[model samples]
Structure formats: C-alpha cells, structure tokens
Target: MSLGGRGDLTARIYRQIRDAVLDGRLRAGERLPSTREPAGRLGVSRDPAGHAGLREAIARHAGVARSVRAGADDVIVTQGAQQALDLVGRVMVGPGDLVAVEEPGYPPARLLFRSLGARVTGVPVDDEGIDVAAIPDAARLVYVTPSHQFPLGVPMSPARRTALLAWAERRDAVVVEDDYDSEFRFGARSLEPLQSLDRAGRVVYVGSFSKTLLPALRLGFLVAPASLRAALHAAKRLTDWHGDLLTQAALARFMEEGLLARHVRRATRE
Candidate 1:
C-alpha cells in the first residue's frame, strides 16, 4: 500500500476503489471520477476509466447489477442468500419508502432494506410468526417468511395469513413471502405457501435451493402476483436472464415425476 517505491500507485488506487465498490460502500451505477482526477488527488499520472473496468469486475464478484434488473430478467443466481438480499434491497426499495419486516428476524434483511433507503419497521413476530396487526400505519411492502419464520422457526398462523392478505389488499403493499429452507421442515403435514393462498394478487414467493440442493447451485425463485410476475420475471431476466435452462428443464422433469415432492414430504414427516 505504500507503493513500495516501485511507482505502483495505480494498482494501489485501483484496489482502494475496488474494495469500496465490493464492500457496498460504492453501489451499482455509482459514478467514479475520471482517471486523471483521482490520479491527481493521489499524486499519480493520468490514466483512463480510473479502474472502472476493475470496479465492474468487483461488481461482477459482488453480484450487484449495473441495471436494476441487470439485463438477465429471468433467473438470478447469487453467491448466497445474502447477495440475494442485497439485490432485492437494491432493486425493490427506494429512498423514503416504507418497508415492513419481521421483528427479531434476520439482521441482514433489515440492513438490506435500510441500505436501499427504506424506513424499515419491525413487525412483531409471535410463536406463529409475524403479527400482521403490528404492521406500521403506511408501508409499501411487507417482507415475511410465512412458510418458516427465521430463528423462531414457526409458520405463520392461518388467520394471520388471511389478515395479511387483507392488509396488503387494502394498503396495496406488496407481500414478499420468503419460504427459505421450507423444503427441509421437520414436522407433520406440509403446509402450502401464502403464495398458494394469494387470492388478492399481492403475495410474492421467494425460495432458494441452498438447503435442498448443493451450495454452489445458487438458484432461487420468485413467484410473483399475476400483476407483478411480469415485472419480477423481468427483474430476474435483467439480473441473469434465466437460470441454466437445461438444469431447470431437468429439475422440472424431476419435480413432475414427484421427486421433489417425495423428498419434501419425507423430510417433513420423517
């Protein structure tokens, strides 16, 4: 970092900028000064792009998109759920927006929402999960884990589910139902998702194959409301275009033949 008297100032400056971008200190589409200006500031010679290419490389590793949807629009493959959280926050929440999240839920979700310029309110969670009545007065989105509440590990109550749907309908708040790790439930009869019971067209279901499939799979899904499905699908498209089509086709066959169902049922009832 001292340049070691070898005049490697460009590499050092490149690294500094790269680290900031990768660490979320510099977000997607955030502008970097011209190569000459930074070099002047750093007492170095002029250059081109000021490591914009390196910054883009850092973004590629961070999995942050240049565009909101990132040009893929179909299936998004993140390094992990955390990166997905970052993506959702970056794309979904804007400044001064209100986003409702579960109380005592995952901290990273809260961070992601806040990072996206949302005023995040924590909705209380009971043994059965988020208390829909605890939702704030005016919120644009309700992000929940209706299938399996994090840490607490209890599915939302049926009545509360209906109540949430009603609330979303009245307030026009989009409901994002994260069914993370639902496939590995250790319980009785499997419960259907709030997405499945969405009659009001407000629920968006999200799931990851991290638990059921290999860690490197990185395949997650967003089953949106009929109205939002197109947009979110476009979001997915712009993000990565689609998951590996061959893998999806093969998995579709496996699921249709009852492979995933049997696996879920067995995992739950075992």
Candidate 2:
C-alpha cells in the first residue's frame, strides 16, 4: 500500500473509534485500557544496543558463528533486507559503477541498484545459479540469491560459489549474498553460505525475517566485513537512527528462549 493510503486508513479507523467512544455506542472504560497508565508502566529507551540483541538473534538463527565465523559485531540491523541492500549500495556503489545481477532476478534489487546510478548488467542463470563468467571485470558489486534462487529455486553450486568468490577477490569487488528463503529447504541439504566460504571477506551476507516470520515486522540484518562495518553502520544511522526497540527486545527474548527455533521447526513440518 502507498503511504498516503495507509495514513487515510489509519485516520479513518481512529475517527471511527473516537466517535464511537464519544457517543454511547462504545464503552471506552470497559473495552480499552488507559493509555497514560500503560505509558507509565512501560520503560522505553532509544539505545542502539537494542540492535545488538537483534544482531545476536540473527547470528544464532543464520549460524553465522559456526558457519561464517562472524561475531555479533559483524551484524547491523536494518529496516529489512531491502534497506540492507540500499545501505550496501550507498556504501560501495557510485554513479556509473557496474553491478552484476541475475537476469530473471528480484526486481526490487535491480531497481534499487539503478536508483543509485549503477549500471546494472543482467547475467543469465541456468540450473547452476548466476553465470559468474558473464559478470564484467569492471563490476564493483554482484547481487545474488544463492540459496534457492528467486523464482527458479535452484541453489548455486559449490563450485560456482567458490568461483564467484575468487572473481571478487581478483577484482577487489564485493558480493552481496541475499540468503532469502534458505531456512525452508524441503529436501536437499542446504549449501554453506558464500559468507561462510569466503576467507577474504568479500561477501556481505543479508537475511530477513519477512519470509521466515512476518513481513510486517520489517526486521533484517547484514553481516559485513570488519572493514565495512563502520560505513554500513553510518549508513544505517543516517537512514533511520535505529529500528523498533520493542520489537527487537521481544524478538530477542523469543530467540533466546528457543521459541524461534521451535517455530521454525513447526513451520517446516507444516
């Protein structure tokens, strides 16, 4: 929905509720709790450390420690994976810089790179994910959905993953690995993330809870190389000082208590 439409709906709902309460149609005292009382009961702070809990939760969920050897400091919370991509684009991409992406790929990503004044080249994908050979040497960033490729649902082969990393290393370029929908692998064993295979810190791993949990939550994170963390964090701060604290705190408790793992298992079964 557009922002204007959402605002109109919210205003309409509020007016309806207010009118009902003011009339005798709705019993506000019995139906609704006092806002002032609830406000006093809850303690809220705008600490960036709130993102730390979320970062840790993402690290545990994605197996960053064991699989990618990344620590909590490597993670930066974003509004969603889309924003994470935007931040990476802002940090690494410049006008006329080349960005290689799959031909039949995620449209928003392609649009995003273009919005940043990047020259996006579409590389074809077969059963083995994106054709690394098609990527130009001048490309500064390569965006890919390695696990369960978007629309096609083909996992990038281990050999392709290694070759992509090697190409990035040789060209001093960056690879943005969007591990979307990897958690729901139904049959085959999931391959290790490119981030895990990368030894030269060439991969920026991005993941989102929108697919696994709920899209309304709008929570996602990026695991970047130590060298890029400061710039990425600055980008995040400029974009939005931080994400929702209450949601992050609640999610932290959920993951720490093992509820998230249980939910994922149950979801997979169903």
User: Number of the top candidate by TM-score?
Assistant: 2
Superposition TM-score, candidate 1 onto the true structure: 0.62
lDDT of 1 at 62: 19
Could you estimate the TM-score for every candidate?
0.62, 0.81
1-270: candidate 1 lDDT, tens digit per residue: 122223345456777688889898888888886776776778643311112222222223212211112112223344346555555555567898999999888887788888878999998899877888789868888888877788788888888888998999998778877767765656663466776677777775555667766667555544444465344434544555434544544444454455655776676566
Q: How close is candidate 2 to the true structure, as a TM-score?
A: 0.81
| Candidate 1, residue 12: lDDT | 66
Clashes of each: 13, 0
Per-candidate Cα lDDT values, in order, are 0.61, 0.81
Per-residue lDDT of 23 in model 2: 94
lDDT of 2 by residue, 179-269 (tens): 8776787787688889998989899998888987999999888889988888887787777877786687678668877787888888989
